[model samples]
Target: MTGTPDAPVADVRPVVRRHHGDEFIDDYEWLRDVEDPDVLALLEAENGYTEARTAHLADLRETIFGEIKARTRETDLSVPVRHGDWWYFSRTVEGLSYAIRSRCPATPGDWTPPAVEAGIEAPGEHVLLDSNVLAEGHEFFALGAFSLTDDDTLLAYSTDLTGDERYTIRFKDLRTGEELADEIPGTSGGATWSAGGTHVFYSTVDDAWRPHRVWRHRLGTPVADDVLVHEETDERFFTGIGRTQSEKFLVIGASSKITSESRLLPADDPEGEFRVVLPRSTGVEYSVEHAVVGGDDVLLLLHNDGAPDFELVAVDLEPVLTSPLASARDGRVVVAADPGMRLEDVDVFARHLFVSYRRAALTRLGVLDIEATGFGPMREVPFEEELFSCGLGANAEWDQPLIRIGVGSFVTPSSVLDLDPDTFETHLRKQAEVLGGYDPADYVQHRTWATAEDGTLVPVSVVARADTPQDGTAPALLYGYGAYEISIDPGMSVARLSLLDRGFVFAVAHVRGGGEMGRAWYDDGKMAQKRNSFTDFVAAAHHLVAEGWTSHERLVAEGGSAGGLLMGAVANLAPDAFRGVLAAVPFVDALTTILDPSMPLTVIEWDEWGDPLHDADVYAYMKSYSPYENVQERPYPAILAVTSLQDTRVSVVEPAKWVARIRATTTGDAPILLKTEMHAGHGGVSGRYDSWRERAFELAWIIDTAAGAPASTS
Candidate 1:
């Protein structure tokens, strides 16, 4: 398996797969066996080849890593949030790789975050959980659920040590600093406590990694005795449990991609049966929040029942929860859906409602006063930035006077703001500490539009040095993720400065299948129209070249997960448009994965990708654009595919197989490398330092490839 960079070959063991009268041969299908010694050997050989090919850029990788470390404040404390009698927060020590969760007594009438200086721990801080200690012996550790009881005496938390999504939940007494015997394993990373704190509800995943069942665990009870509260048998729907904002009911929600059904159990009645709020409809999606309007218990429903975008409506809880046929449309409309804006989410407070929406490809927050006269007009939360991302932060308390929000742009570091609902005045709690000198004036951030093939204007956000000449000579990195209606917003990143300082321009393509423009934008890029996302990205690249931002020889494209799917498609669609492509945990084998229902998350994803297993039309449509099946014997950009051995979302084999096929089929001499993390999940490494090193390695490769440097040999 060990070979030179120019001719590294993977042993081919062809597997024939047939679906809908179509046949395809997968030559590298044997790479799926992670436990096989030969498969492991091949992965190691590929890793060695990648290392040998990039050994020349070792200095560059270190420089970038050092720049990132220097810019970030190693020792810092987050804004302290006041919950009940405690002002809870987390802080990072200079050398530690994780945060220490702590809390102190809250001062009377003080709703603002406590003032804490950098590098100094707060007085009387009670350390609840130290992630560093928990992660000390494990190669991968993720702190999942961190829920405290209403009395604040006991803490319930979950941990995943193997990078698998399954978590083990444990209880600890905050006052005595003693661990409880109530250990629950195989949870789905969330736990909601009853009002009496005697019982807690948690969810568990099925073999396919879909959260399928909710269970009730009583204090001091044996794990075998825990009751199964609700079970969702439908594979298409995933289930989750949470307490409503009013703290009156426990919500168990079952949802597929397009439809949702919620069951409510009163917080006071821990042994009561859960009742459905509304029956699930084929194409309707809605979320419910408990609220007290006009002294009546009402449910605030954010639904797209009739409105394509989404509308906020007030439904009488008594009727909707009691009747199976009652729909949210029978309720009074509060905030009617607007064609131009897409309502992303709604947060309910005691006296106000915070609505997060997107318009003109930017996130905006609006506050509405919940008064006796229905609801007041929504007032937009003011942000001065021309292109930035802002949304609600951690507001756990239902009746808090001030709402916490996070705001940042490409050039601006993230800042925590406390906004007053009544006065609309925002108080800065803390701005991100960049240790090395950082000046927002030294960089430029702006939005540009590219005309797609269908003449649709697509948004592109670009950031570069203020004085960098847009002469089509400087190298550029274009990133895009257009799936699941998820928006890749403009946020602060200290690691990105390394590229900007090196005369590289960075841009994000707000293509369709993303919520940047609106729900319509996402609708236009998903299902049968999914090809629009890939083509839109290519159009953005062409626009960048035509507008003198960069040339085809100096452009590098990147994306991860579904976005990685985007990278693979674009590489096949327009290979000459970029100098290199970097895909992380890519879903390249879409057709094969979607056809197998047993694959993790395959059934739950049918709404987004269409059901290809049974429908021949969908099978043919997906087959036409599926990256692995569509790979042609043509010149391709320098490609790097990175995956993780433990990733269940997009299997590691997808990338391994895709890389092998690309390397064997492409006619060009450019390097096609595959790097797999042997002990990580969908998200790469767990620790901050490990993640930084991985990113530095990637940026170094992109810089080297964009510079047209020849691949290094052992």
Candidate 2:
């Protein structure tokens, strides 16, 4: 690869799209045709340009990749989780690309995970499915819907060979070590089996890639004879199927951004019609879990009915099934929503209830004991770290005495613990092994506040080497993902050490569009207030600079998907704020995609971005900050837009068009590069090794750009 290469120019075919009395011209819209030879050639040329431009950093990229590989334990086993008669876990081999799912026979009544040494396999281990073997010949492979029957005699799994989300479902008879004759195609990647293991329920996506239908397949029956049990007609709603913790009820759930409806059928009665537990109402989202309290079947409902942050309520099972809407309103409140905490989810066990919530931008887990005294006080599960992510792990059995919890932070490797509700004691089950001598003492992680334009305080998690200077002279990478009420929690990464070891500070901007600060934080950043996500990100960059952590000349902004949209918007909104930008599968063409309801996921995203095609106000509001439309003739920072040709959520055309337009419009000579993965999806390449290599490439480019390497325009 040479240091200098001519930038490819895309053929401009102006396509006019009009909505709400507004007209927009998309110059490179024709690039959406993925099969076009010219389009492929253009993408290939851009990839070549990127390779030539970054050829000087090849050694650095390899070094980073090596560091990542060395730090990771190539051959390891996860903590074994006990379910019924077996202890199940997954193991990784040295050269394999995927995990080998296996299980061992359990000594009845043993709730504790089987203790196994780092390199030792468990006794009597039987391999159920080896993803490495399944993915041997596939370039891109994703395993989904790994479900087992109650009897443990059969296994059902799904796989997606292409980047598209559609998966194929297949069954295997564990006893015979052979795949069954039944094969189902094009599913939503989830399956639930009846208690008797006689029937399996799965969901299928519509033309828009929305899971809209649920079907039941009796064992040994042909695919054509499968019964469609439920179908959600609302374009905004998605459907899924799952079983309750008690394994008594098979649930069909239909949900949108703000509304939800659930139907339940006895797991023993697979052919029975499902009865609605609650009717869907606008702006009311609720989830239900079944439990037996005081010898009576009860339904625990977590809903945002009167509390925006959500609250927990309990109702008698029969009453809820008889008159769901009324019973839901009359239900007794179990845990009222607090301003400082957002009730995220509730998992019910036979004798206790576990609740997971977010408080002050950190995760917290609480347990409620169910005894003869009705219900005990909600006890908080404690963690030592001031900044870490903790949540409930796999606790599949309802009669289990221990609760599984996972905890980790920026400097700490992930650890699994088993908590005894009776004694309030936790037993350390396993902690991820960092092979190449990792020491937490060498690093520092902390939280800092950034004041948004609207006077809202946003939390930013920053981690760096202990010896790194605070004099604003070091390079920094600021990451942000502030959409869909998703919180970007601080967690440990073996690959990230490559940056910190090289005198770089890594920070996560918990902006308004994220759930870190609660539901209100997310509400304040979406729809008409969407610009807050971008401005809040900019504010975080400024805060880091003002605090002497790093300066604009040494800063690189990074985000993917909606956050990638953020990278694009910030480039247009505050071009001089960062030295470089790395956007992966960016949703840059917001207004254009959102305006076309016919596109995949367009209608489903209306609740988050608003219906830009129908509402003039929404159209104008989105148009004001739509990155592609707002690009100006300014000296923008160097940009590396990474995308995949087979991405379904955000089309590859988005970043391709954005890079083309930015290159054509920006006055700066800073290189604008696009790298499209021909055989990957939204999450990029599937294998761990492939993913690490990709990260090393991106980080190397970032490190180079921060060190003041201008694009070679020769």
Candidate 3:
């Protein structure tokens, strides 16, 4: 594998795919016509053979992109947050690639926040929409829908520019800074307004990009007289549109990967009609929030019906806004199911409700107190970092007398405090500065576990640099995703401090299809127990190499989109445990994109990967772990993958056909590669110094393949 650069083969055209009686053929399904010019010249010859095999790590990718732009503090700002009589924030401008939004005024009762400083602006600030002047000439820019009104005098944003998550919307009028002729176009960047800010609502998608309708518009409108309001014709549901922080109702919602529904109306009756509330079932899941309690109004919800780590309850919002289908299952429990806590949402706050949940695998938060009998006791909210990650940040004012929260931890950096809720006190308000002189007690973080050959302990977390080395001569990484119950929690990463100041280590795993340790550890790793998320990520890489902390020849593994299908099914299930893998944007041709429901989020990922096109034992349990139908021949570790070609969620022909079938079915010589991003999408290169030079070219190929490992043949 020395300076190897030749690999761009992928042109096979077989294509047979016969369901359950299972015929399967497929050879690079013609790299799914990414507008074929030979699939854009084979993704520009696999991005020029991954820039000539990483041209000997171009000076270690410009010294890890100048140590992530010198420990990043480049003109920062964000903390403001008040909303209503203004305060909001967002700055960043040392050679800005985007982010400027502004606001200022708020002092009516001064709930404190104001420090402002950074490149100095504040006193009546105002600016509002500068995303570096709308990401000038876009090679991918984002910000979809910003929203405003509750007398902030109209703003409603949105703008995508081509990372294909579609969005366009417009409007502004912050009382004369002018701009609204009301634009609209394609949408789904999210919007919601109405309390007499003259109707906005939003949502749109379809053509398998999902979202499916919602609409409304109005403020001097004509986007063909807008109005639809609801649609979600079940391509396994999706739709959305929000509002209620007691600005009184708007909601909408729809959801699928395990059912959900909602509807509501009256944010001052935007032409009133909505209604529903519960009516959904099939493996029920719930969410809604709005509260009032003593003067009775309520909703709260959270639900996972018979609670497999979910349960909050408390319904009766005037009989679901006066009966139109009122069915939140007769409410009244307000946080019960604690099979080791998982709950997740509920924010309300006039006199407090917050919540958020997760417990042992971390991310927690609590508050409660809106009692005239209903919610008084919760309270938890403490934090001194034992593997941290706190929640509920920008408290947009529903009688905001404090409570922002944010926190962080793999050796902490993200920090934002405020709390109070009538004296649980806490204050802090800003921590992320980290420039080169950085020091989080020189890093260290903890939690360990592993187990899982079906017994299942899992957990992991780690972090390093407190003079790195838990014995096995350090060089770890690890990471993992597990799938939809999402949870890869413990945070902080200023480009992961160029791999913990070079001795590496990192970690994460937590395995079992993720919502960490709850919802029955994501129903035991999804669909027919999805090979318990690839043998719980190969039992957390053989328990981080039998606990010496690293050496399976210096371990690497990583993940992305469904944890790049758990780094392509643990490189076909533990290809000699590691030395490299990466996988960003990788859903690695999972049974030809979940047996194609015309793709794009494959019918709401059949309740988190199952109905393999009408289940023949979920097409033999997803063709026995579909990482490009289990690429074989043997030995494979050095990989990379990354992707984009306008990724409408995983499809740069599934990592250009899984790096052309692992360089034609690898048997050894481990150099795989791929790259792609031709003007990005699926969150790739959208400028923050081109995403820190794409994380310094994937941390200079994970520090030259973990310092080209190959020693402990133990």
Candidate 4:
């Protein structure tokens, strides 16, 4: 043995990829020969993931079993303690399924999920919302809405939670509690009545997830009206512009973008051909927003003029509806958020036009309560965070006015409140609970800025116990969401209370590509700028260490799906930054997954992460960080990667291959385990108890690894 003071000689066993050092090429060729990656090798890998996940679950199950007992302590907890991809399942009481509880939080008193004797299986004894759950146990939730008629005589509803975003409308008579076939396409939403419920108008989506023509349901027929009100496809404008929550205005873009003529049609003329609205300019890009007013008042349409810019312009329906439809380009100003960042949507209710920026970010909720000039000074309802989305008028009740506010904070549970606009006071309507005696005050909240590699500032929110020691080595776990314009905000969770009680510093990294700072922030951090997001997360980890928030040896990082990819990539980029990494249903093999169209969510996300195969630029950039293909025989954090076998979204094979590769390639003995569920979809678990058991398993891993035990003995 060479007596080298610097290097302590030790027998090193390489991991992850040593065996397949040269076999990958030949195996890969065979895979290409059949053009089917569902090979025997892959199958074996899948089994590996199952075994690892099973053992890990067993570990977690053991640790959390005692913790799962219902706490008799009256500890009031607020917001979510942990974060994960989830679903809305039924909680039954006695034998009745009372209300629909989403994986989302309850808005205080207004939407408290009914108490259920069935525990999490079915819930009951309160107001019920007829929304679709993940019934088939898939990754998708169906589209449905519940509305009570003015007289409460009829309960109008639609029941298509998944097949199409379009709903199928039906009515139930309260008197008999029977179904009434108020047959409607259920696609064109907002089934409002015409004065005396003569007809109900609605909109629905087509096969491609695009909004189709508007349809009206007459009081008599079991079928929708033969005549279409408006076919979004024929509007001489693209229909899949945006969602109801985010899209604001539609601008007939440049000729190159549209390729055809642009048009505007009157609402009354269902059979009318498209009326040219503006000349199609080659390569033009614009957006439009329309607000429909009641009865005699004309509809207000807003258009953005400058390229990548926004200018509020209005079109009066009274004049445009009568005269061949006026060009949408012809309008007056209402409001504008920016020119570069596209405006997402506008909500117009009695005397208020709430404008939203970046779909819904630091939402201004600018209420232009003006008939003419000079709307009131914009009321800045602060908290104004990116992780949470705030909306108005979820319910029309006077007691919870100030406009009904629906708010969700990262780590905080979702809640809806009634606010008196005049008083700006918030009154709780409904809220979500895990039924445990835990108080939010038991945790501390703090915000700090971390400097990225390029010196850019990233904000982080940390929550921990009040008496947390500044010992710099607490088992701190940091989470992040840095892609697809999603904000990681407040949410409530039952799984995290135990973690908090044990002194875990739960933090969220509000990195780039999120609407946290408005459009600019998101635009700057996505696609080509995607590297910034990964680095930003790394910086947040470094900041935690540097500030004694959590040190390098004790810091753990966790992320799911896209965030999981973030955690995986950052782990590869900086192995020493964390002690353990938990990636749930992560897109670790980004490039390969995106290149395949068969994957669930890929086809729908081409716009977000550009198609890789056809575009070499996207391929190269994605390859720059995809964790799976980039595996190296280097040291890595003890990793607990999870995925579901039945997951129709992110295929289970992803984690399978990733774990094997990492296990074989990495040098250190630190365990890199995969947990795959055999009978679940993207969520991995069916019931609350099952989910708690899985969560407890993860916490157990954290406890064992962070506390210095065999990483994965089982």
Listed per candidate, the RMSD to the true structure in angstroms reads 2.4, 2.5, 24.6, 9.3
Question: Tens-digit lDDT track for model 3 on 1-714?
Answer: 565767778768887889868797878787788887988987888888888988878877887777788878789888888887878898888888888888899889898978888898889898879987787877889998888888898888998888888888898888788987778878878888889788888888888798988988778968898889789787988988887777788888888988888888878989888988888888888878788878878777888777778788887677777674444456888768878888888889777887788878888888888878788878787787788888888778888778788888888788888878777777888888878688889888889898989786899988887887778878888988877888988888888777877777889888887887877888888888878988888888888778888887778888888888888988898878888899998888887787789878797888887888887988888888888888899879899988888989888888888788878988888678888888888879887998898888887788778865322111
lDDT of each: 0.90, 0.89, 0.83, 0.56
The parts of candidate 4 lying over 4 Å away from their true place are 1-175, 180-313, 319-331, 338-345, 356-364, 372-374, 382-390, 396-402, 407-415, 430-437, 596-604, 645-648, 683-687, 708-714
Q: How high is the lDDT of residue 410 in model 4?
A: 40
lDDT of 2 at 214: 97
Better of 1 and 4 by TM-score: 1
lDDT of 2: 0.89
Tens-digit per-residue lDDT, 1-714, candidate 4? 133112111122233212212212211222211124454445445446434534544645565645653531122222211111211233333212123432333344443322323333322223234332324444333435554443344555665433324456766665565667566654533354332334454565544444445555566676724445555443223332111211112222212122333334433332444344444444233443345444334444334444243445556644543454334455555564354344555555445556555333234445565444433444555554445556664433212224656776544556767555554677675565545555555656667889988887787877777877767867788888887556665565555656666667788888887656555566667777888888999899888878777677887888898888888888889999889899998887676667666544454455567667577677777777888777888999989888765455566656655776677678996766766665555656654445656777777777656654323311
Q: Quick one: how many clashes does candidate 2 have? A: 0
- lDDT for position 569 in model 4: 89
For model 1, how does the per-residue alpha-carbon lDDT over 1-714 read when each residue is reduced to its tens digit?
Answer: 245455458898888998878889889888888899988888888898899888878988988888888888888888998888899999888888898999999987779777876677677888899999999989999999999888899899999998888899999999999999999999989988998889988999998999999999998999999999999898999999998877889999999989999888789899998888888998999888888777788888889988888999987787655665377787788888999789888888889988999999999999889897678899998889999999999887888889999999999999999999899888999889777778999999989999999999999999998987899987899999999999989987888887887788899999999989888899999999999999999999999999999999999999999999999999999999999999999999998899999989999999999999989999999998989998999999999999999998999889988999998999998899999999999999998899899999998998898875322210
Worst 10 residues of 3 by lDDT: 705-714
Off by more than 4 A, model 1: 1-7, 708-714
lDDT of 3: 0.83
